[model samples]
Target chain A: MNHQKREDLVKSVLFVFSITASLILLLIIIFLFNEAIRLFQEVSFLDFLFGTKWNPEQGLYGAFPFVFFSIMATLGALIIAIPLGVSCAVFLAEIAPGWARDATRPVIELLAGIPSIIYGLFGLVIIVRFIKVSLELATGETILAGSIILAAMILPIIISISQDSIESVPKSFKLGSLAMGATNWQTLRKIILPTALPGIFAGIILGVGRAMGETMAVVLVLGNSENMPEVVKQLLGKEGSSTVMQLINQVPEILFKPGEALTSAILLEMGPAQVGGLHYSALFALGVILFCITFVLSVASNYILSRSQISVR
Target chain B: MINSKTSDKVMKGVFWFSALLIISILFLILGYVFVEGIRVVNLSFISDMPKNNWREGGIYPAIVGTFYLVAVALLFAVPLGVLTAIYLVEFRKEDNLTSIIRISVDSLNAVPSIVFGLFGLSLFFYYLKDFTGGPTIFSGGLTLGFMILPTVIRTAEVALRTVPLSEKLGSYALGATKLQTISRIVIPSSIPGIITGVILGFGRAAGETAPIIFMVALNPTMPEFPYLFSQCNALTTQIYYLTSEAISIERAFGMAFVLISIILISNYSARLINKYLARNIRR
Candidate 1:
């Protein structure tokens, strides 16, 4: 074949290969929905989503507790992560010296690469035990433990992305702020951070998505309770104010420990749920929920970033 | 927040604390795992097979299993990912479709590994079991391959895109075909970057625990001992089983130690390779 014809053929083949990404995504969504939708045949969607109990053995498929805990754990992690992650980003981008930045950057990369299993181990041995003792809780496996571990796990992502945003803020903004006799910190707070807010928001949204999707690390630490939130009872006692208080005061030790968080519930159930059974389909439904959440958040993050980029124009 | 008399000091303290917290967390995990697992990491610990549900003996099968799965995954991911990247940065270069493909790939990268696990189960195990014969090396490796495909494509694309347009133009000026120019000029120059991507992907695949769990379902025996059609074990899954079911935290730590070091070493080398290539380019 002539060179031009050969090139065209190769280009076509590569183009076909390139589209494989979108194809795989479509396959994933289809597969998740295909299996997940079957659960509604066995259990009502409303009961599966909003009911307070979830025992596949008894055929009760209320996943409300798991869903609630997943969001709660993610929000808890975000609370710890946002301030710390964003501050670290600011320090790295705006304040840290070259040597300091160089030293910490690898640590952050290494931090990101550590497996969730290892993080689970860490949470199991350290954080869980620590919380159990220091917080004087019935079990250290509270949602707080999961949140702490996840916060640490998601830190590198939040810091890296936010740092990119902070760094991308034009240097002229700093100069402009300093020219008005503003201090360096003042310039950062008033000028650089504001300029980078949208990007920073995008990073946090991504981090939240990450916190939601995290499985193993969270599974190990989250008390894996699949019970309704006892918000009022946990609050009134105020001994630990955390889910620990709920376990301690609200729910009787008589009640079985809260069943399992969403991911853990699916994971724990997966082993026993007979293949092609209603239980299996129910587990797949949870997987579908997990997929939808992270997928939506990822798409939302991209949308925010694209909108921010265009809005600047 | 930065306006008070003590605000400067407070900000400095917080900044230092943040930096210290990040560094300390890294050290804490590294130090604790090494301290706990160092005693168990003798040669036999790595090379010997597990006995009695991993309560006793080494994790040789798991060590080998990790290599097998990662190797198989790379076997599938590297070629397709690199070719797809080539299409993006070289063949198609720039267009609306290219951008859309790029965005899709990025989102795919962010999908939780657990989601991939679910897809792998439904697609590979339940649906394609006839071809895969159920949860063997083919199924597990293919699953992990697709899991890391985005990473490979992304890194390789970035590398290919970095190849100067001048070089491709020069090749064209000499009457070289696009394929020839790419093979001779573009791929060769971007090989370092592609290797870096593979290395990074290696780290990710090494540490990933969720995606391959159900696909392979942890096995006690070594994989690829004779063939890729058998079920296999991995360090991550082994650690999970050992710690949870086997109730052997020490052994789990030992396995985790190996796993963490492998991931960290690959991650460091990937970063180091990038720096070296950059310095060489400058020179």
Candidate 2:
């Protein structure tokens, strides 16, 4: 073929393949919406959002409890993962010896690369068992366990991004602070932390997105309970536990159960989830919620990073 | 001076503490899995068929099945991804069309894996199941191929972009056709980048549990090698199943350890391939 023909053919091929990617995304949204339409038709939007109860058999649909629990667990995970992940990044970028940094970074990256299922398995065998034996819990699955594992899962994302952010702060900031008689800690605390906050937050937001949508790991550990929020309150009192415990208490049990019709529809119902069931639509709805949350978080992070770049300039 | 020293100690402490935390976590996980997984991960474990007794079950089928699925998935994904990247990096100008492609790729990467499974279930299962007669490895692979396409495009594009423009100009000066320049000069230079992207995508595909769970639902008891169309078990699915089994926590840990080790090895191999390509380029 002539050069013009070859270029045109290549362009056409590339365009088609690129369009495949877009078409796949479009297909997912359309399919989910089509299947979930039946769910909306049957259940009131308000009930799905605000009603206190969730029973598929009776056709009651309230997602408030699941949403609340998902938020609490994810927020709790962020609380733990962000600080530790940032500190790890700080150490890797700022203070670690060359040998240590080289040795540790791969291990962390490997940790990041390992599939969440392995984490889920690890959590199930270790964390859940430990929780059951020590805490006298009804079940091994709890919000605390989910949060802890999630914190671990998101740690690498947070650390790597924050390390980049810290590394990007320009050496002059560190040198300038030291030149001004500020100690390393003071410099890090006063200047580095502030300068790096935007990137760090971006990383944290990424991690948050990971935590919120994290399925296999959380599903494996969170015990699949689908209780109402008030019942969760009662469970918290009986558990009589720490702040983490109370938070765990607040997580509705139904969302964690296999058959319950609330949160975690994706992980729980992948195969055996009845066709066109409320469970399936709820899962799609959860996907919509998850997509929106992650999208917002990503936008915020990008905005923050861009603003910080401007400030530094 | 006192304050400076105090802050130094504090910062150092935090750093060390964080490092220690991460290291210990890795150690703990690896240690636990190794301790449990090794007990059942012998020749028998690899050779035996799925038996009612979880204790004596083998994973030969799963290992082979995983490779087959990944290979087929790659066949579907790599060409398209490489082509897309070539266009984006080599030919396409920065316009609305290009920007749209870039944004879509980014969004693809962020879409959760479970969502991919749902998409696969509906598109491949509901719409096209008649073509394949319900779930087959081909359908699952097609779905996963689409799932990993964005990663391939992004990574490959970056890899191709990293090729120096001078090479392209030199090819043109040599009276080489544009196609010749791309195939001979640009791709050769960006071999490392392409390999890196492929490696990363392969790693994710190898370990992905959510996307293929529904697509390849109900693990086959024994894998048919000659019949690649036959349903088979994969390492990810095996790990998921074992974890969920009431009596197989030990097996689950063992499988998890194996999966993690395989991922690490693949990554190292990919890195080695990149280095080798880079070395040859210099020569």
Best by DockQ: 1
DockQ of 2: 0.61
| TM-score per candidate for chain A alone | 0.89, 0.83
Residue B11 of model 1 has an lDDT of 88
> Taking the tens digit of each residue's C-alpha lDDT, what string does model 2 give over A206-276?
78877776777877787766674454545435444357665665454532332222236566754555777
Candidate 2 chain A, which ten residues in sequence have the lowest lDDT sum?
A: A254-263
Highest lDDT among the candidates is held by which one? 1
Sort candidate 1 into its docking category: medium
Lowest-sum lDDT 10-residue window in model 1 chain B:
B217-226
Q: Which pairs, if any, clash in model 1?
A: A224-A260, A224-A261, A225-A258, A226-A259
Candidate lDDT values, in order: 0.82, 0.76
Residue B90 local lDDT, model 2: 78
